[model samples]
Target: MALPTHFDSLYIGGSWVKPIGGETSAVINPATEEVIGKAPVGTGADADAAIAAARDAFDHGPWPKMAWRERAGVLQQLHDALMTRKEEIVQLCVAEAGSIVPVASIMQFDMAMDGLQYYIHQIERREFVTPSSVSAHTNWATGGETLGSTVKVYEPLGVSVGITAYNYPFFLNLAKLGPALASGCTFILKPAPQTPLEALILGDIASEVGLPPGVFSIVTGGADVGEKLTTDPRVDQISFTGSDKIGAMIQAQAAPTLKRVTLELGGKSAMIVCEDADLEQAAFAGLINLTNQCGQGCVLQTRQLVHNAIKGQYIEMLKAMASQVKLGNPADPDTGMGPLISAAQRERVLAFIEQGKADGNTLVCGGTIPPGMDSGFFIEPTIFDCPNNSTAIAQEEIFGPVVCVIGFDTEEEAIAIANDSQYGLSGGVFSQDPGKAYRIGMKMRTGGVLINGGGGRLNPSVPFGGYKRSGIGREYGEEGLNEYLEIKVIDFRAA
Candidate 1:
């Protein structure tokens, strides 16, 4: 991979400048294992500068006072600039995020464009908001006094810290950024250490659109920078998409400050396949969700709840499809699966594979590395049929291309086993019987459910989030924007 020296240096208060320390972090092409570019190696002081910039933008700048129509125009401009660089963004994201080249490119660019359009349409459709509650008194209408509380105004909250994970860096950035920015709140995004280039590109687009300085900033760094951003007093909200352990820690740290927090944490989502389901369709959906994206997605159907009547047949179908998943180089367009994020993650996946074997699960497909692919962080798409739900593989989030298949006797049993995990993110149920699908979907308690054939890819209009341990708050819709806003009621005194 060729390294690009001319990259987004750092977008600070209305200006792009070099890092204060003059240090940089190398971005890698996860697929080809080469240095691609460098993002600023931000420090605690840099975080302070970003926060101060956001605070000034919020408290004393025109961005906060700008009319809604003007603000909407700014967002539209940002969308247009991003769309123009759609292909470039795809290439950058694929190189940085290891998403199998063009597929990753499509997701980073085309999908984000769709989300931006969603925001534009959604904001345009809303009428002026009226207050839900009002107080009126007979004596209220004194000399030159107003009679009734006319409206409830929504105010943008202060600055927000948006920390994205590596697996879906570009998508995650837009998922949080769209709602936060559309709500009129300023934001500073901290991309994951593994993939910061996508966020950098997004920051560059913001600059290109003349997004007011202090309104949006991108400071790329590791755990230290993330900690500084989360703990800082200037930031009013913290929205993070990552592991549950880190989510808990941030929650604890942010409690003393009383900062508003939104977390889209980890999940062990399940896909239940009932006996009444069309075997072919259910199996296909199951494998696609799990194996595609190399099984790094959080809402993927990692647990396959198969009815005992069709367990054998379903396993056979799953095996055939799994074998067809071509794995070698992500740069190859035909490659079905890509490598995990890093060598440590690859080793982690390997340990879980060993654990599954020790727990007496039946290993069906892909337990070792792909042929001619031992250099990069690659793992085989693994499937395990554990007779009991108590197995380690069923209990843990492997965060790799490994899935667990558990047999169930009844609908109730399937739901029970599926809901047994700590995660309630995204899930699905496949059944030709509409009643059964609806019934099971209603009972699953996940954030999103695909009855029969719905996929994880969502439109910008749809609200996406998780429940229970899976996540907090929503992303991508009207309600999502509201999450970043503070409701304020202004009582009129003059007639």
Candidate 2:
């Protein structure tokens, strides 16, 4: 596939625009360490323009005033447009982000389409206003009885900024954009510098779809652009997906304006393998997902908690599976994993591996760069036997293809270890006894739990968020839409 070397302009206020800044950022291909594309670096002026445009749209444009069905129709058109470009988008994602073909096609491409379509479906059947039951209340001013009725209405929260991660750029953008736009909120999208090309394509599609000017915008830059969007009072809300470190910064920046923020941050999720569990299935599932997106995902189960009795057997199964995984070119159908977003990210993961080794944790198979494939920012699928749960490698969120197997004596210990971390995004349990697994899952402190290998996969119809530092608000489904809406209550009394 031929990649565009230069996107000469950024998309703002529904138009192809020249960025205020002359500097540009190169979008490097992690697989080959080549500059696949370059996006015009956005400046504070660019962010101001985008935010002002969104604010204008929300305050006075036709988008917020349009009926629910009218907005739903536009969402349907956007969904159709995305469906038509499925192949091109998938190929672009693979080229720019080093997403292995199989995973990219489903996650970065197909699921994004599904998410937009899900929002469209939601609004098509949605009720914008609901009537509350009538009740009688004392009229204090008149000193008389009054019969009253109330109606509740949902309204958009004005301008929203979506700061997405590099791992799943397109999906995260759509995850926030689709619902926010569908809910009548004007939006400014800021894609991560590591993978910004595909998101730039989204701006093209939005324009081609004839979305109202100033209703949607995409700004491409580093932390400064994001900071400008977060601190500016014009931006009414922020939906961010990335590390906890940045999420905290966003929360702090939005504090002065009290902007509503929905954050999907990092996770050190656990996959508990019980004594009676299908050892091979549970272990393999955990390992495969651990390397999914080269372990860039926030929701993957990185902490494998196996009962002490079956730890050896489970570790062996993971090793066997890890050996068979092909880790070369992402375009190859047989390749199971790909490089991290950049050399910097690969080094970060490698540093964590070195730390694990220094801590005397058992290195179970990977943990080094694969032989002969030295050009790409690649790290082997690494695992460690971390006996102490308090160890840095065991406790921290190493956003890479690394897993730690912590042995637990009982279900209580397994739950305790899983919930011990500050993160509470998603978790899973494996056991032959469904009831036992269910009981354990219920006790977990995480926001979402899987019983018998049932979670981790995205279900657009349900809510997805975290507890503790994992995140503040939910994304996907009705919960996601609600994040962009505000409630208003109106009372009617007999006159």
Overall lDDT per candidate, in order of appearance = 0.80, 0.88
Clash count, one per candidate = 1, 0
Q: Pick the candidate with the highest lDDT.
A: 2
Across 1-495, the per-residue lDDT of candidate 1 in tens digits comes to: 232434546766766767777888777776667787877888777788889999999998887677767777888998887777666676666667778765576666678778877876666666546665455456633544335565677777889889999998888888778777777788898989788777776666687788887898888777778888888888899999998889988888788888999988888888899998899998888787767667788878888999999999999998899888887667777888878888888888999999899889999989887778757788888988889778778877778888888999999999999888888898889998888899999999789888887754666677778888888888777777777888766676333
Kindly give the stretch of ten consecutive residues in candidate 2 with the minimal lDDT sum.
1-10
lDDT of 2 at 391: 79
Clash pairs for candidate 2: none
What residue runs in model 1 are displaced by over 4 Å at the alpha carbon? Answer: 1-8, 131-147, 492-495
- TM-score per prediction, in order, is 0.94, 0.98
Model 2 agreement with the true structure over 41-145: per-residue lDDT tens digits: 999899999998899988999999998888999888888988887887888788788899977899888888888888988888988799988888789899888
